[model samples]
Target: MLIAYARSLVYQEQAVRKALLELQNPRRKRAFGGTLTLGEFSLAPHLKTFFQGHPDVDFSLKIDNTKEVMSLLEEGILDFCLVEGLFPKEGYDVVLLKEVPFVLLVSPGHPLAKERKVSLEELFAYPLILREEGSGSRDIVEKALAERGYDIHGFQKIIEIGNISLMKRLTEEALGISFMYEDAARKELAENTLVQVAVKNLHLTREFNFVMMKNHLEKDEILGYAKEFQGFFAKEAGRF
Candidate 1:
């Protein structure tokens, strides 16, 4: 049985290994089984690599609003999930993975594209393309606007889109201005297809975290995976 477990771990071909490793009590080895939601902008690229490194896991993905992600966690449908937001409540545990800065994205020819710094009032003049209502990005943007005494009701035009790629495409076409993470807009910014507009005295940011029930915190398997993920992100974080 030990040999079989070793083979399973080597192949990384079964979620059983991950489940077994997470067990705090030997008898509880097979108790864990559920889906996990990984919420972020364009996570598919990274998730593919993550699963490849642990082929034994049988988890699936669900792309949904951050609110939905939290709701699912509360419903016990998701074993855990990564999200960009404040910690949910007292009963949960959150490991803050990273903090991302938000920046304005616009087409190359947009008037404010060349500006070094723009005030919140100046940004209000243009048509804004925002993420869906429950998005972490949206929450940060709304909070920033509120602090500046500006609200969605005062915008010239506000459009909501559910997908990040669509928001990028729309911004590139000069259809609207968008606020997005710097990492998400790296390629477009590099190719000169889009420009990042800085907001003066307005530093928008969000913290990404891995959240799970308190009960899972003591599980060795869960702890090991969390540590591995933390190390992976730590290396990546250094580059940015």
Candidate 2:
């Protein structure tokens, strides 16, 4: 059985393609091996719709940190990864997908929630909840703060959380404020569960990229999959 490990975003596309492939070659379905393993960040939702009709192939999902995912790729435990922040490593090939803005999120009733924008200096007055060190989100936040002369040591109060969902929940419950992708908090903001707090003159943005080891460059399946995924992202750029 041929296997491919990927991020959650490809689940729907995988299902659509698999069904079409099977339909066109029902008699010799065994010719092409079919199996997919998916791992994703906590923010990525389940992709059940994509796997509805393809039951022959094994599909497994695991929740792992970004560092773990990258390590798996290096060890050949995964075929590729769709993640943000990190640049391409020496042995890896990367395709830049899209850039996402990092913004502060707070509950609707929080004081800063009413402000159109707050500077990094002003944000220091409040407690901060952040992701673990290797996380893309954490890296972006640290860089943005450092450029403004706000070192980690200067943060008034800090709390570290490994899970993105938990960080959002804590922010909502007023445990502390956090910074995250604007899209990730869209629903919560619209529903009043959270509010976006702008940072004055600071545009903390990061690019989301797809990556695979260089050895996989010529593999037809991997290349085809990459192209399809990249096309999908290009089409959806405006929505994000």
Candidate 3:
């Protein structure tokens, strides 16, 4: 987190001051750059277009799971963050930038691959792959199950993995089944390497939130950029 904080502050020097001055005058070219934290890799393609239009603005982009993004934002280490899944609203204010659906991911060879949908009870019979403790996907899934009167630990052979790439690789190898955003699994799905499974009665959905300090909303300098950041996703969010 400290490394992320330092890297983000690099744009805080002359560039930022000059940018802020330019922001005051409409006729001047605007220049502002800082750091941004991202919880979902799916947002990268959209952000690429945004950066192309703002050449003068330099930003440090950090990729982390939704769990860590919330902690960093709450500690004020990040000016703003985009995350998958829901976060607590106590210390942070959030805009619903988008709503994305998740699907069950399994190897093509898995018996359930040909099935349109499977019950949650049948999924419990297999070895389940889950994200690490701080993952937003894991949190939401667990919460959903708990609400259904299911014990989280009741799933057989629950394996915890931290790296998304590695997790996908393991799932492709038919080690276990996992859940992820459909967008993230696009390539695998296209190539027929991974098959998406739908849950019979469950809808796996989450939000892509633009989150920041609630109090900062009333401040000008931060608010302007924060709202601008939120708008980027808000406009494109309709595609989801």
Alpha carbon lDDT at 151, candidate 2: 72
Worst 10 residues of 1 by lDDT: 28-37
For residues 67-129, write the lDDT of model 2, one tens digit per residue. Answer: 766765555445566666654455556766567777889887788888998877887777899
Model 3, runs deviating above 4 Å? 1-40, 217-240
Q: In terms of TM-score, which candidate is stronger, 2 or 3?
A: 3
Error of 1 at 122 (Å): 0.7
Mind giving the per-residue lDDT tens digits that candidate 1 earns over 36-73?
A: 11344434446566667765666655556677776665
| Best model number under TM-score | 1
When 1 and 3 are scored with lDDT, the better candidate is: 3
The TM-score of predicted model 3 comes to 0.75
* TM-score of structure candidate 2: 0.74
lDDT of 1 at 110: 92
Model 3 agreement with the true structure over 104-213: per-residue lDDT tens digits: 89999998899998999988888888887777778877888898889557777888987777778999999999887776777788899999988988898777676665
Candidate 1 local Cα displacement, residue 7, angstroms: 38
Using all chains and alpha carbons, the TM-scores for the candidates as numbered come to 0.79, 0.74, 0.75
Task: In model 1, state the lDDT of residue 235.
Answer: 79
Better of 1 and 3 by TM-score: 1
